[model samples]
Target: MTHPARLFLDRAPSPIGELLLVTDETGLLRAVDFHDFESRLRRLLRLHYGDLALETGEAPRSTKVAFARYFAGEVNALSALAWDTGGTPFQRAVWRALTAIPPGQTVTYSELARRVERPAAIRAVGAANGANPLSLVAPCHRVIGMDGALTGYAGGIERKRWLLAHEGVVQAKPMPLAT
Candidate 1:
């Protein structure tokens, strides 16, 4: 059986960059990706949804408000927002586990694997994290390297740093002193 093929798209401006919010006809969020990462978003949707149709439109009012509140530093503004995405069972499990990570906190890939009850699937956890289509809403940016290093983010490491600093998980870099 084939899934429905209807997606709504919206461009929302944020401190980090413009974000593309994709939703279904019923207003369930499907993806939240950076503008520069549009190609990746397309690839992800294509990989999962297969020939879905996209239309430019305003995001749902609640979604817009949640994003506004989130960017305003509420941190948990999006925690309760409803979202749906396509993925395998393992990926779904990993994505569900990701939502349990509180804002301003981070976990290593290995720890995420343990949280998903697949402690031996650290690499699999990382792969699932990499495949996350919801971006900030799923909080994949909260996953870091075991050594406390900022690792790969579909939104780019600099944006990851900004998000971590925004969430108080990491201190922002000090500005240069006047010469």
Candidate 2:
């Protein structure tokens, strides 16, 4: 079995603050909290990767390159690169559907659930959305509450606002820095 190990880390300064990006041996893990890298990484290691050891380093060239393109708004599609999104079969299915949601567009959680043939599984769909690991790459931020209000985001609501604003969904005062 492939053991869990830290691949690399990079700090990207954004409008909100400096985001700590982490990746595993597979692909981009998540943008972690700015100052809580060690603690959050440790918790993630235990919860997601079990007791596997972690080593801090630079992000892989491929991922770094992809992120660069993404941040530049020159690329929006991310079918390339291997991702280890730890989720159940149903959740994976939901996340795959999320990727189909084009940039600069938004989808309600209920709509996403219905598209998955899980009309009554709205809450489940939200759970799967909250569990999305690739975050912006997977485009989970595009999902909103039924009332069209920002519901929940693992990376915090401010980041969600930035993502939606970046996509031109809900117009904010000033555009967020890409990526």
Candidate 3:
């Protein structure tokens, strides 16, 4: 039987909340989520990795710097971060399409489905988006409802709204995340 990996777990503060970052020994990002949603993170880790050994450690320096820069208003800062994930081919395709969504842009689930050439699988696309393990690094927050409403962010709607505003989708001043 294959053995799951021992990953490094680190926590950092972001405007949204405390971020939990998991990376492999080689420093490749394995997962990212809010501290408040650790249960979800653990669930995803199990879903993808079978079982894992987590050590209290820091993420790679470059990854940390990139995230800090993104939080500092260099929204495209994460475009170059190194990360990895595993899923079905369709899920991988949807996650890849998400990265192509340039900073400051938002697309509906229908449009994301179209990008992956599964124009009729909008619901499936939404499910894949939800299963995204590398949140901001994958840019899944940029996806919105078909009617342009903020919808279904695992991180919470207020954080999603703050992210959209942080990316300049709305001109209003950024709001603090709901506690």
Candidate 4:
């Protein structure tokens, strides 16, 4: 994902909230974030791709259809969609690892850190996870703390909880998640 990408914008309703999907002309997903987090979304887009026009347009049919299916109970619908993001090599690696996490499973930041082969980079992994532009598609919500406690999620903790339940991951939380 180079800077100054010509990205198209689309919106779709989901169980959690309204999602704004950013896609390249070729239908490659560039980003996905909630409409309520428009400011954060803008900041991330700017940070990742620099200056670019996010024109008002419909995403490709496949992109829209995939999301529809995803929210409609076809949990694996998103696995086939092509997405790319602009980030440092490390961030990209972390995002790829996130995608590898199956929908109904989770891994701690330390575990994810080791998965990236940078065991000492747990904090760095957490930072990169925070910077991920793709939300549900990248499945960043599946990353948790080492104590089986839900940690920070860019989409918010409640949404993370809903997503985990939606995916059938039952966890015994040892601590309270801030509302």
Candidate 5:
């Protein structure tokens, strides 16, 4: 029998801001976005799982603990949380590549595109990165501009800076321009 689609939402305080966590019934993490952008979170959910039921419930115990640990300076704490990705093939590919970006390290949009084996799709990769449903978990904050400057982040550039600083990547090298 097919299991019913259910999403659980909960709020957790963080150093940057309050976070909105979404998890499936079996405790798989669905999305992690800022609580202030509730509409964006809902829009993402609807985009991923059309018309699914949502309920305000406690986040999974382990997920809560992981977030606590992550905020407590355990950079790898979130790496263990299982994620339930819901996006298009390209988005999924981009998100998967994001996970490979180690904490305390940053990659340019072009570099991310190269990592995903689509070197010519820098703009597309940037779009996918912006559309990431899972924020900190996928490390989308680690993607920077080719000039080693901060760029647009769904959670805000300040939060991105905070996340990178929290991960010990205060300074990043500029991507070498193509010859």
Candidate 6:
């Protein structure tokens, strides 16, 4: 028998702004900003919940604790997370490489592809980065453009800048041209 789909939401103040966290039986599916957030969130909800009841104010027991630690810079790494990924094998490989990027450090798409021994798959690596489902937990935001410019982030460019800034990346420095 298939288990019912259920979603729970909780609000937590984050460095970037107020974020709405959503979780399901599968895992933590989304963490989104509350203000000026796009309607894509509802679409995501429909796709995941599929008519299942979305019960708010019932976040997983200790999620707030984790968020507090993460925001305070006390949690340099993440563990015990339940991530649900459905992507191609190559995409999974790219996601795995992304997780290896430590806090406060960054990597370029081409660099990541090279690490996977697929230097020719830079474009493919970018595609996989775009397809990552776990967002911040997967640390996709740490991937930057080869030219040192802030590239695309599923969460939006502003949020990406905020994440980098929060991690001590100096935005005022001039970006280097891609070599």
Ranking by lDDT: 5, 1, 4, 3, 6, 2
Evaluated against the true structure, the overall lDDT of model 4 is: 0.87
- Model 6's alpha-carbon lDDT is 0.67
**Where is model 2 more than 4 Å wrong at Cα?**
1-10, 13-15, 26-42, 75-79, 171-179
Clashes of 5: 0
Clashing residue pairs, candidate 4? none
Candidate 1 residues lying further than 4 Å off, grouped into runs, are 171-179
Residue 63 error for model 4, in Å? Answer: 1.0
Q: TM-score: which is higher, 4 or 6?
A: 4
**Model 3 bad stretches (over 4 Å):** 1-4, 171-179
Residues 1-179, candidate 4, lDDT per residue (tens digit)?
45544888889989789999998877789999998898888888888877887888898889889999988888788888899989999999999999999988999999999999999999999999999998988889899888889888888888888888888789826348459
What TM-score against the true fold does each predicted structure earn? 0.92, 0.76, 0.91, 0.94, 0.93, 0.72
Model 3 is weakest, by summed lDDT over 10 consecutive residues, at 169-178
For residues 11-125, could you state the per-residue lDDT of candidate 2 as single tens digits?
Answer: 5554455556667656655434444334654565466666655566666677656655665664473446556645577987898898889877888898999889999999999
Q: Give the per-residue lDDT digits (tens) of candidate 5, residues 1-179.
A: 12337899999999888999998888889999997888999998888888997799888889999999999999999999989768888999999899999999999999999999999999999999999999999999999997888888899877887888899996854334459
- lDDT (C-alpha) at residue 90 in model 5: 90
TM-score of 1: 0.92
Error of 2 at 161 (Å): 1.6
lDDT of 3 by residue, 103-143 (tens): 88899899999999999999999999999998998889899
lDDT of 1 at 38: 92
lDDT against the true structure, per candidate, is 0.88, 0.67, 0.86, 0.87, 0.88, 0.67
| RMSD from true fold, candidate 3 | 3.8
lDDT of 3: 0.86
TM-score order, best first, reads 4, 5, 1, 3, 2, 6
Range of the 10 consecutive residues with the lowest summed lDDT in candidate 1: 169-178
Residue 176 displacement in candidate 5 (angstroms)? 20
